[model samples]
Target: MFRALAVAFAVVLIAGATTFLALRPIEQVHSSTPVAAAPLRATTTRPTSPPTTTAPPTTRTTTTTTTTVTANPVSVVENFYAAINERDFATAWALGGRNLGRSYTEFVAGFDGTVRDDLTVTSVTGQTVYVSLIAWQTDGTPRYYSGWYTVSNGEIQHGKLSG
Candidate 1:
């Protein structure tokens, strides 16, 4: 009876120890704070040049005088009309800037059957020159017209026609 009771107590103690181990929470021996890893080194054999330094710019004061020479607006308009009256379309077109926005053929066609009879400069304001003119059509009918021409860089840039 004594040996049986001793064997039974030993079995109960072993079972109790196994149950406590299985239910207990596991613990770590190290700290929870993260450890910083060492920086990795690069292996390269490329040659590097030393940094360069530049001198500061010097400060100076100098006076500059500019001169501009422009052709007379009245003369430019007169020359352009003279070319048109002579049926010299190429010269007329050349006298105008790229802003004319018309082809040589179109320019000639627009002036077809038109002859400039007379012209007079009415006024000159800065780059704009105004002129009054009388023209004859193909049927010999007379037409009166007034125009304001804008000249720039020694070339006729644009024009507005009115009656």
Candidate 2:
């Protein structure tokens, strides 16, 4: 009976060991070095005519550049007033008549003895700007004036004045 029990225990231990060895997981090791591939050679259908080579066709490219100029309404009015303040009659006159129909002499005579003390742009409607200003005559009389000035092409085309 003791020999039979010992044989049975030995058989069970051997079976468990066999099962554990068979079910154990396997680990794979990867190499860190890069492997180079072999270069490919082109094959030709015909070995005759010394393998003639043809050049590709040439292409023509055309480029066009365009420029646009736009005038600012406020700058025109400000520059006109600046020319007037500086007593540059010729420049002031040139800055006029895009919309205003006054002649050069008339424009110059209008600014005579009229010193612009202060100017305030009240509002702007399209190309027209309404302004209120304080001016003085040659006799030193202070006057309040308001007017609408129309500008085009950096010039004063027309103006309406009231005091």
Candidate 3:
């Protein structure tokens, strides 16, 4: 578990340092009605340590996380999903995974079967950015979801997303 965590952290660092990153599409929404993702629930909990559990044999297991932030508010949302894609909950939490509305452990557990997230910034209105996401499950099913994320500075403040 610890080795896996190390790999996840390294992935986040390499992704952050790598300059050949894909350019994410950006556009402004001109509609009178803004596309907003309703808050599933807003709870930001910062866990000092990764989650762990004990078994009947009195053995414990550990895990890992990863993240890096950019100044652009929209980029914050992008980074958040990036961490999720890498299965780096630690980095995801730092990148505003807290806004996903769950404790660190629960938040990590939430993406149990999620394989990857293909994200796009559909619109930007001040600190609010609308997003369209395709969450792929391990079974190879793609679920479409659209929502908005409210960012402050480089952290995701809160927002809502639903499929």
Best by TM-score: 3
> What is the C-alpha lDDT profile of model 2 across 19-46, one tens digit per residue?
6665666444567975564453333232
Worst 10 residues of 1 by lDDT: 42-51
Off by over 4 Å in 2: 1-62, 97-99
The positional error of residue 101 in candidate 3, measured at the CA in angstroms, is 2.1
Q: Stretches of candidate 3 above 4 Å error?
A: 1-70
Q: What are the runs in model 1 whose C-alpha is more than 4 Å off?
A: 1-68
Residue lDDT tens for model 1, 1-163: 5555555556666767667766666554576996664454433232233224334589999999998989888888888888888888788888883357777777778787796657789999999999898888889888899988899888899987777
Pick out the ten consecutive residues of candidate 2 with the lowest summed lDDT: 42-51
Clashing pairs in 1: none
Which candidate would rank higher by lDDT, 1 or 3?
Answer: 3
Residue 100 error for model 1, in Å?
2.9
Give the TM-score of each candidate.
Answer: 0.54, 0.55, 0.55
Ranking by lDDT: 3, 1, 2
How far is 43's C-alpha from truth in model 1 (Å)? 99
